[model samples]
Target chain A: MTRFALTIEFDGGPFMGLQRQDHGPSVQQAVEDAALAITGEQVILHSAGRTDSGVHALAMRSHFDLEKLFDPFRLMEGLNAKLRPDPVAVTACEVVADDWHARFSCVGRRYRYLIRNRRAPLTLTRGREWLVTRPLDAKAMHRAAQHLVGHHDFTTFRSAHCQAADPVKSLDRLDVRREGEMVIVEADARSFLHHQVRSMVGTLAMVGLGRWREEQVAQALAARDRQQLGHNAPPDGLYFLAAIYPDD
Target chain B: MTRFALTIEFDGGPFMGLQRQDHGPSVQQAVEDAALAITGEQVILHSAGRTDSGVHALAMRSHFDLEKLFDPFRLMEGLNAKLRPDPVAVTACEVVADDWHARFSCVGRRYRYLIRNRRAPLTLTRGREWLVTRPLDAKAMHRAAQHLVGHHDFTTFRSAHCQAADPVKSLDRLDVRREGEMVIVEADARSFLHHQVRSMVGTLAMVGLGRWREEQVAQALAARDRQQLGHNAPPDGLYFLAAIYPDD
Candidate 1:
């Protein structure tokens, strides 16, 4: 069987999540079903990251194997055509070495979270951005975010539902900045515990809102207790930006 | 009576247009209805520019008058609360001079058109941006757009339904730039004839695609004939970015 890697972009609002689920539809099920219709092959899609419902992705990498070989461009076109009416697009597709895996081969991952700091109700970007009515001190949020940049036992930020065996992980970067009414937070790491990013963002927001002091973020991390978590940001504003590979 | 000026932002995907229509719903109708419900009096909402069906607004300026006066802050918050689930927001509201008019007092209007030039189907920004599946040379498009700037008779670009008495209007700027996979066209003018920006952009796109020479834009303007127009772009990508007033 030939292995193919696909880069996809999707609006996760209508999806149950990125992974296939028995509960409802997912991005993986949508693409796998589309592949079945095109190539008459039932395939399992393995993505680099498993996103929760209501989370978006700009370029999430995934891989699958097919018994029949097809040109990457034609395959991409056919997949996109078959995935119609669904808010999902296969932006890039290519053949990969049999040993290259979409998830296991990846070296790093990136995510971006957006907050619209305003009192006005959202209109244009309703499901795409989180609307926060309170004024956010982005500089304070940025300073607080620095406390989570290095390696740590992030038990305070890990979700109770996380399936990862270890609570300790290395966080490469976490930066916050404000642009007009938007407060943007960008994070990078080799891998993250489920809900870690959201948990961290929610805690840092307390600092921006002047509720939690800057050093409190460090204290929360050291406590390493889920109940000690400040807050957990909604999935509405989070986006799986990209997945990094060794050769890429 | 007290006059109030409002700055609004709306997603036009659900509305027939910005103006009130007998056959369908509109942003103006939504705001007017909200105002009537709030003040128990019918008030007409006048906007700086009349947008076509499926056109969005980032900061459209509008005004309305009411016999019963309410605090500007209270009025704005109430309107936002009443306009729920309609994708319209009163971003700002303030008391204005009785002589001030939303349409007449505006000194300039700004518009932005976005085109996603890619083969992939749109997911997140379906109605918010136009999808064009052709490779466009933005530099050529920009050069061609320059031909339509300055004072000119724009009969070729004006829609047949245009009610403007004269087709001659001074266009201050028409710029075309490429931002990654998107081609953005920004137009600034004292006023524009119906369908002027879309018509000009459609004609300029031909030059970008190598179908029409750069001089064709100038020749089309000189002809001043509707039949000479190359194309008319769709309304999905057009946005009333902002209304410019001389005072501030």
Candidate 2:
């Protein structure tokens, strides 16, 4: 048996999520179907970070085992060819040790939230950015985001449907900055609670809009109650940037 | 009559072109239909630059006349609301002088062609960029591009169906640069013959890929023959960036 790791990018607009689902199409299902057609083997792919519907991925890492002998490069090329008409691409593929797990061995994760702060309705950039008509102050949002850094109980920022075993986690970084009319929020951590990034970004947007004070984010985190959450941003603007391994 | 100037943006994937066509929908038709619905008067729309099918626009300048009096801001908001489900937006609008003309009064035009240099097939940027699997040397392309940045007879680059009165025109600027995996070619001129920008970009790409020598572009220009053109790039990556008026 051979284990292979794959790096991929996908547009999540047409997908239910990264995981396979009985009710709808998914990125995982698309790849699995392609593999079935190419290798005649039903392989279950495991991804480093699980994403929600309407969330894009720039470079999501995944792995699967194949009992049949094949070249990794051929498999990657074949997958890309077979995954036609779907918005998914296998960027890099390599043979890995049997013990190397895409999810378990991952050491860190990164995410970015994009807000198009403009009066114009989105044309070409629709579904890729959250449009905020009201002007936002990025510096204020950055100041508020700093309060969510470091280890803390993130219940106030978690989704009610989150399946994580614990709410306490260490957030390595949370930074906000503006480029032209775009307001971007970047976060890094070993892991995250479901909807954590969106919740934090939504709350920070209030600070950016002068609806909440900068110190209010810290207060919400200390509350450790889901009901105290300020806001939950839509999934359209969130992007899973990368999965970090020890070697990377 | 009230003359209103508009700065609009659009994704040209669904339209035939910016001009009103006999067989297909157009950006001009969309705006005209919306304006007629709002004011109960037939209106004709004119734009600064003419775009081909599958070409997008960033901030295209246009104008139209209406006998009914209306505030510019309200008209903008109404047009945006009326042009729903279509990938078009009016970013800015204001009243213009009676003699102002969208096409004739324009002093300059800018265009950018995007080439995504990567092995993987695009997902999010599929229609917005041209994907080139081979590595491209943008500096080499830029060096070749400098060969076309002045007054010259551009007959080799002009399309056979071109309607321009003169084949010789001044190209104020032709520059190429790379941002990460995107190779961008930006062109500025008072006017361009049909297919000139795409033709020049395609020739420059040959130099970037090492398929043609650095001086080959200059030779192609001097040949003044359409058959001597290296390549005619597709309209997918071309963008109408903006129209430059005297004040802008």
lDDT of 1 at B162: 99
TM for candidate 2 is 0.97
**Local distance difference test, each candidate:** 0.94, 0.93
Query: What are the DockQ scores of the candidates, in order?
Result: 0.93, 0.85
Worst 10 residues of 2 chain B by lDDT: B239-248
Candidate 2 Cα misplacement greater than 4 A, ranges: none
Q: Which has the greatest lDDT?
A: 1
Kindly provide the TM-score obtained by chain B of candidate 2 when compared with the true chain B: 0.98
lDDT of 2 by residue, B113-142 (tens): 999998888998888988888999999999
Tens digits of per-residue lDDT for model 1, A154-242: 99999999999999999999999999999999999999999998899999999999999999999999999999899999998999999
lDDT of 2 by residue, A108-208 (tens): 99999999998778999899989998999999999899999999999999999999999999999999999998999999999999999999999999999
Pick the TM-score winner. Answer: 1
TM-score of each: 0.99, 0.97
The 10-residue segment of model 2 chain A with minimum total lDDT is A226-235
